[model samples]
Target: MTDFEYLEPEDTRAWVLHPELLNTPAPARRNAGNALEEAVALAAALPGLDVIGSEVVRVRDPRPGKLFGTGKSEELARSFKENEIELVLIDGPLTPVQQRNLEKDWKVKILDRTALILEIFSDRARTKEGVLQVEMAALSYQRTRLVRAWTHLERQRGGLGFVGGPGETQIEADRRAIDEAIVRIRRQLDKVVRTRELHRASRKKVPFPIVALVGYTNAGKSTLFNRVTGAKVMAKDMLFATLDPTMRSIELPDGPKIILSDTVGFISALPTELVAAFRATLEEVLSADLILHVRDISHPESADQAQDVRDILESLGVNEATPQIEVWNKIDQVDPEHRAQVISSAERAETVHAISAVTGEGIDALLATVTGMLSDPVHEDQFTLGFDQGRKRAWLFDEGLVVREDQTEAGFDLTVRWTDRQRRSFERL
Candidate 1:
């Protein structure tokens, strides 16, 4: 057995272990408490799982075989016995051997953080692209746990089937099932990607400056989307309320048209599988002329959540050169004093705006900021189109790119001022 290097906790080590040498570090559990709450929230969001109770188990010197110390494991087991808990949700990563060991000792089903997230994403994904991505991510994750293959759960196309009796049977893990499934999903996803590329190319002809709204989950992204676009999208105070991407054409205060894309909200420790799978989904952000990073200013972990969004953005290949605006949302929840302070601070920041999407406060300023940002270092050009080029002429007008036009006998002479992206789109057309 390889000796595991359980990080010796700083505080509470002397006390927790004097009681028992191998007791989980209390400080570690306290640090994990917030993550455990988030895990519980994630469980609550999912269907089919009845969460009885959840807590953080701090393992001081995490053992290779059992993870927790003998005493601590017995203590948790007693609690499980008393509560008749059916499933144990771990807030952190777990090795397969430790997972098997914990299940045997506790006599209940178990799901670690990554598995739980993957399962939730599996349940929530709607479109064909989303489904394929989930399957690919799940298979990739499951590949790691092939060491202990139990496949009693009936495979469902929609959900990652983690359902069954105490001791289940292993089917796919043995026959390179995941490998084959991954290959198939990749082939399908490739087609979807190509189709998306074509759609994007088509969108280029229309040439609407894309302004994508990104934020932490439950950060009022959907609510803001509805407020800005007057388009009713599902807005709820739930984790991952909006899964699929949605876009609508919205006009700025002064009438320049830009496309507003409401993207899937981000979260801390987003599953690697989901990230890779959904990168295609977030491809909207890549081409976005401006990225509006909406944030929940009221949440205690708002700063941390903001950092997580930044991390994911970088991971998804958002370049530093791309224009990004920080939108501090939910100021309506704050007191008047705090709200004033927030607005003042945002005003001073170069590319930050504070707004309450629900109350419509500060939204005007935010929109004006967006318009100004879009209009920076504008490009003006002229083109002569024949009578047959009415569609192209109409496209230019529709995009609000035409500054002046003179009808000539041959056709129309048009003067257009537009961004480089708009220019490129016009060229494609």
Candidate 2:
């Protein structure tokens, strides 16, 4: 079965299709190539899957009736018959009419890019809000594709012989029901947003800085998040493994407390419908005090993926305003020479850190640097506590990173620069 609880044919074969357009900036090289790679990766990631073959087609003039030319369609039909391919996975969004027409030609199940992403999200989402947001996005995406996608939905109606309780075709009924569900989900999502806003406001009152982790899918953001916060979040090699935003308190070497949030990873060619639906979730990134742009240094397309992430951030209008820290992750996977080049290049950026999340290398430096970046300029105060006074010493340890220590005759005299929260917590102690 697919991730969305959709039953899959055991003896099914899938042929991946891509439409090429030379006029646009995203031609076959950029769009089709990247999308096809991801589609094949997704197919491999699925629990149970069978792939007969994959092909890329370039249609000079995309027909309104069918996405492919007549000749190509006939070729594909013949190929499917010969190979017994039972499904077609299109890398681009398909209009309802185009989808219906294309399916008729192939006589098999067809899935579009949006549906595939939704199915992945349905499987990855863990929290209640996460599930609701995914469902909301899927519903919104489905609303438009209903005509071509959901022809299987049917409702039985028999009231007073002929004209009865609901005098409408099953399609119309399903559309109305889905519309109502969308409305309800939006209201629920509004509530979720308000609740999140309240939590954010509360954190603002506490004065702990909020740092959000964001990057392209499988960029090691979740792994870095786990490393920094000591939270056991699910960090896998697959795409879109972490959906919901998770926040945790982490202590810096200097004893400053910060709230670190791991957010949904961005992807190239993310559906516009989903972006609109998940606006509330993206708000967390916008409200962050610091944004960590994590990059999987080992990926072949890491730089392009970083650019894609920046483009999405720009579209969200949070790119310019948010203070950013560039985290080059997965140094463990990089070769020595390449890793040296990356590290040397990264040193030019003002707020860049290189680390390996798997090995915990350079993490302490990352945390210490973050604490230093967040240091308040208003004050410089230090206090000494005796080691014999365990409570006082422990209080000092929690409040600040020790800068200088003296093992005096009286006790352990320590000098520390405290974070804002550490100062407050220290006073209470």
Candidate 3:
């Protein structure tokens, strides 16, 4: 089998490893440990793989050729041999040369954070766009790391060997191939983006105001969206469960229609490459008329996670001034008294919607608030439309809150509440 397609033996064990500098400050080391643990847990959840163990090693001196010093590298080699580890998973992005050197020295397959996460996403992606994005990210990541199994060669005379060595390096060939793949992927993604733009344009004319659900990974945004819209989007307790955005129509209490979109959850330090690759998916959040920022209020890092979501949104050039409803979700999991205290301390009375998505708690109030935002009056006009103009009536039912509709002998006499733009359209009709 080709190297890319070859699977590790079933009996092989995978080790999630992280390296820290020995002289690093205690607080920094502690954070590294936490990050390593998080990465390990995520790695362990990948299907068709067995995680034998995980560890953090302190390298006394950083070696340019390898991440660890000579002695530390020797020690790691011994540990790998003792554990019979078939794969070494690093907790950070590694350059192609570094990956090749590490695999050769450790005598095991090496995968850095980007590659491992890409592998898991490849397994979990369900939609066509999702699959394409994952493949594109993976190809972009692997293009640099395509080196031969080993790079050890005897020193040779100065003439042909010196000239041949630099030109024929496996790393260079891999990088060139990766560039080609990236070009192809970008062209394909352009098509996908154009198709998505068409859909978005159609949605704009549909007259339903869009409400996009967004938050940190595993923050219950999907759960809330599914509850409100009755969509069967995947709502697992894992990072990036819903990579592709999904939208469904929901009827409000006042009979007006609104579109609720469930988008890929945000995360702290999300890989830039993945973000660029999933631009088509994220455009949903960018164009949303309103954003619901869901939060797992019970999590210790909830505040930091919320900040991260804001940062990502800002980076995407999405207007922070756009309407946002801060939905403190998963409140049922917290102590009732604590939840009450949190709600009391929160200052944003109008913009905050505290509720537990898993339960039918406070959801009605939140939906009512969203519907009010959609149907709120920006303009008022009187229009007379013929009964045959069903499109105008339907637009009123969908985007505007109809106050009165009466059948007249000449035509249908209707009183519609809508924006000035809609009022103009009605006048033309």
Candidate 4:
């Protein structure tokens, strides 16, 4: 086995390939050109890589040893050599054998879609739990790729070892070693999950409804979150921009206070290992009182992308009964003619709202709709409290539930209109 770094220097020249397999079922095959563009964007997301070029390779007959036929493989090898490409990113799954063979033939490092995603996750995970989850998923992915003789299992940088290190010898990771690492990570992750559960439990006692934002990657979920909460989450025009979930308490206009959760964006064909590992992080969505399914209406493949998000939600066992509002975001990016059509279509559906988070267009109406959906039925009640019970009286006034107050000889008499949740909270106080 030969040991060598996968990537070199700070800027690795990279090429992206999206194989459009003609034999694949129509439902499973994505738009080849659009998929290629997304793959290029993903390559651009990583910090140290310089994407030189991209292509959509049409594959009529799949080859077992190498993904491409011999002549095509040689042609690509020549191009890679000429372009000085250090890495080739395939926008689909490649068998371990195929990966090894392609690397040997092309004389460059090969990363499949799963490995690239893992690398990005490793780079973007901020929280401790998120880091552990990405590590576990990377280990699971690396376990299978260990079949290749030139395996680089040691990390010399922030990202997972899938991308090469500088002047580092490749170390073969035995199954036992990988398994032990996984066990250690699982123990840490379990502790983190327990702590998160405690926090969630505390939030439940506060009577604030949770509204979770979920959508495909780079679909403006974080942007919408920032627009609504005024919190500076990393809202970028890149894939997997936000990895860890962020929560903020926000009061809807003339409505009940709620917790808004912005979670890691979903992607089409998300790695199964990651899906399982990040389940703990996504529990916020499962517990949400309402879900906002944000969509990039400007994207050509918007409908397909929306379906992909719905598929992931279903796989995560999100409650079908949970109320969902379709937020058609990025309307400003659409052409004026198309934008008008989008607005018209959204107007026809009560559950759908078309708005641009960046320009603040149609945001008030969306907020009003959210207020209406989250508002609970209110009833009037009278309460008598002594002057000494100032804290309870203050709580009612702060919540804006007091209808009227009258001073009395005993203490004070209050007429309040409040929801069941508020009433319960008041009793607890």
Q: List lDDT for all candidates, in order.
A: 0.78, 0.75, 0.74, 0.87
Per-residue lDDT tens digits for candidate 4, residues 320-427, read: 667899999999999997888999999999999999999999889998998988786889999799999999999888778888999999988999998754675577
Q: Which stretches of candidate 3 lie over 4 Å from their true place?
A: 1-12, 18-34, 57-62, 146-173, 335-337, 346-349, 380-429
What's the lDDT for residue 376 in model 1?
Answer: 61
Question: Would you estimate the TM-scores of all the predictions?
Answer: 0.78, 0.77, 0.76, 0.82
Q: 139-175, model 3: which lDDT tens digit per residue?
A: 7665544445424422210111222343357446556
Error of 4 at 124 (Å): 0.9
Worst 10 residues of 3 by lDDT: 153-162
RMSD of 2: 11.0
**In model 4, which runs have C-alpha deviations exceeding 4 angstroms?**
1-10, 148-173, 378-429
Query: What is candidate 1's CA lDDT for residue 327?
Result: 94
- lDDT at residue 353 of model 2 (Cα atoms): 86
The model with the greatest TM-score is: 4
TM-score result, candidate 1? 0.78
- Candidate 4, position 247, lDDT: 96
> What tens digits encode model 2's per-residue C-alpha lDDT throughout 1-429?
656776655855777776665555653256566657777766654544577777678777778878788999999999988988877788777887787777777887777878778777887777778788888888777667555334332221111122223433645665777789889988988888899889875775676877789999888989888877778998999888788888898877875688888888888789887788777888877766678899988878888889989988888878464568888999899999899898887777778888898999878777777777677554456665665578867646553567778787877777777655355435534
- Residue runs of model 2 more than 4 Å from their true location after superposition: 1-12, 26-32, 146-172, 379-429
